[model samples]
Target: MRISATVAAVSGALVLSAFAVPAAQAAGSDAGSYRADVAKIREAAHAASGKAALSGSTVASPAADEPYALNVTFSNVKVHSGKPIVVGAAAHVSVPVTYTLTHGADVDITASDFLTGPYIYKGTYAQPTNMLFGEDAGTCTVTSATTASCKATIDIYPGDGDLSNVDAGAWKAGAEAIALNGQDPTSTTFDITKVGLADQGGFASPNVTRLSKLTVNAAPEPVKKGKTITVTGKLTRANWDANNYTGYSTQPVKLQFRKKNATTYTTIKTIKTTSTGALKTTVKATVDGYFRYSFAGTPTTAPINATGDYVDVK
Candidate 1:
């Protein structure tokens, strides 16, 4: 279930056709093709039922208008161990996911055409604005006849339209599974009835934030007491659109000082970056200490602190 390509919409429903493996390559242990077929089946079901495109977590049973639902559920889902995903420009960020899959004893989860994994998305589950999935299929270890523990990796490419600045903030987690049952989804007469699908949503919420950077330099390495000392620095954050770090201007930053030989730093004053994200300030030299800058961060950016600059006050 790799998501290296951007998710596109067909008939107003998000589709994975862009990254779907070709039909000729669907015969192997290629879980990507199986997942893509599951998505296609979901789209067909939605069109038949005249409902909006359902999310990957939607569950359905063989009924008058839906594909056969697998008797499976996902639990104990954890992404990055509950930590926020902080991504930088132009780099691929890989996130680890772990979950427990519980299913009926009749379900053959180890089949070549069967695959399941966790995903994260922004917006509603039924209609996600954007979504991300693992680069490879999940690997599972059977803990019991009916349960398995699974681990997968979610690969994010900030430079490849996988994310944008507006995507930063909270994201919801979900899990999905599909069983093709040896059916050829690429056939024009492909039967959807033989496929099994299960989707579960709202298991957890994880934060995604842009990586931030800060740098500081205090002038006058050796200064006389009572003389003014100047501090200068810059603040920048990841720019997903440009695939680089750019100035994060007009944001509040803190000036901190730690006396020489001290292990703690205390805030000296609060200041804001210039239009170009540059920082400059002056403080009277009163003691031998180290100076630095700190950014408390925002909903879209991660917090960071500059390395302290040492100054010997004579």
Candidate 2:
């Protein structure tokens, strides 16, 4: 994924928490210097389903009554692997994004007024298929005068079927933030215009692969010191649609051998599977040892190694 110059700009700031004030410190009345009212805002911002919904039309460039101007800086977006999101067994995923909201002069901040989360949209910015991931509570902390750092952890769940029609490939990450009115939720809205779109570091679909199976066997269990010994195996992988494991024809499998009582195994040769994923090969049996078939995984499937089959040489 390529992050547009626009998305790359809004990549700074930190997380948020409930604004706290000591009994002696007076609340600032300036819009820009005001901190948010935590209690009332939480009720309006969060839904029972636990997913923050920021599904409103694009507000005019500068909406009226927009309490504060925004300077959002998102942290590097990454998956659990500390890399681009790699969809896998865990359908639900969360990515961390932080931002700093600078309040306007005398604009009191509240939870309801602020909402941030991760968004995925396909096509051009002018016209795109947009999907919101997660917008839960962003525990915030006030860092400087009129500046508050907020961190939001966004969640993505494929099972929700939001990106079902979307192709299984790269998707842009558009981190968003909005300021709403406590009295009138839809009144005025302000957002960071330039959200950082991750470059080669956005969302990814699970690389779907069929389950693969392999087998190994050795012939002439009691072979002579220098007799020719045969090793054979079949490599097959599951077909998702068919729900069965079938031949993985024309793929290569490494024939490996470990000497008796040895800890490591060395590759003897590379052999290709037949049209039916069948394997047959010969090697000189020198010592009682174990033979196995190893397959280097493909894009869609994971790598696997079969259990070693022992062959005894008299």
Candidate 3:
């Protein structure tokens, strides 16, 4: 009886050992995966820090009320790790952009940050089938949210590079080697044009070398007490909707007005535009009280779709 009991105990121990073997192996695998994740994150952060280094002339270029595109050129980048980097292996890099506002007080600025295809700033554009995995939004100022010239952080990851440099052995099924997608480095365009602000019209072109650079401004609208009128005044702005009036945080209710037969317009008095569009204001400069105005300009980029309203000039 004693011998039989001892044999049973050994049998139970053997069964438990067999089960433990697989769990131990799985733990080892989990550790390896964790190490790989850490390495990849470190590599991405390093890449972004490098992008922070640029000459003053390189990052920021355009002056205020000027149209410019900051073109960042990347020298061919090679991955030193002979290990394969997956499609999503990303690097974060920030490009420096400089805008010197000639008339900061007078002009409202609209800007957006984007790298590859369509972005959210000026309006969302269609992202292409072969879009790169990078984005620009570090320091962004648009008509919707205007700000002073500041540094914007951007993320740049790969869609391509060269694999021919790696050893063919590293390309083996179970090995790591750098494989590339060979796409262009990427570009972020910043177009500054005068909108609803006071303008003196001497906006110097941004200090960037480009094939074509242009600036189109909005003509000042007329000041009126109350009414919804088609604002026809300056450059040919493509998207001309009341929704384009992007001042999100300002007091929504006010007495608004434009003048009759005026080249430029100003606020007549403080009045709130009811759902019916009505408002009031107390200002000195009063034009012949036509009380409404709109804008005219060519939009290199389109804002959202919206309509203007007519309010009472009470």
lDDT of each: 0.77, 0.50, 0.21
Expressed as tens digits, the lDDT of each residue in 1-314 for candidate 2 is: 11111111112221111122223222443221222332112222222113222343222332221122244444444323333443332245566655555555443445544554444444433333333334254546777666666666555444443233232344444444444443432234422221111112234323323346889998989888899988999987644333346778889899999989999999999999999999999999899999999999675554679899998889
Would you estimate the TM-scores of all the predictions? 0.82, 0.47, 0.18
Cα-lDDT of candidate 3: 0.21
- Candidate 1 vs candidate 3, TM-score winner: 1
Off by over 4 Å in 3: 1-254, 272-289, 293-314
Best by TM-score: 1
Question: Whose lDDT is greatest here?
Answer: 1
Per residue, candidate 3 scores C-alpha lDDT tens digits across 36-67 of: 32223223222322222112112232222321
Ranking by lDDT: 1, 2, 3
Q: What is the lDDT of residue 34 in candidate 3?
A: 28
Which residue pairs show collisions in model 1?
Answer: 57-199, 57-200
Over all chains combined, what TM-score does candidate 1 have? 0.82
lDDT, model 1, position 89: 91
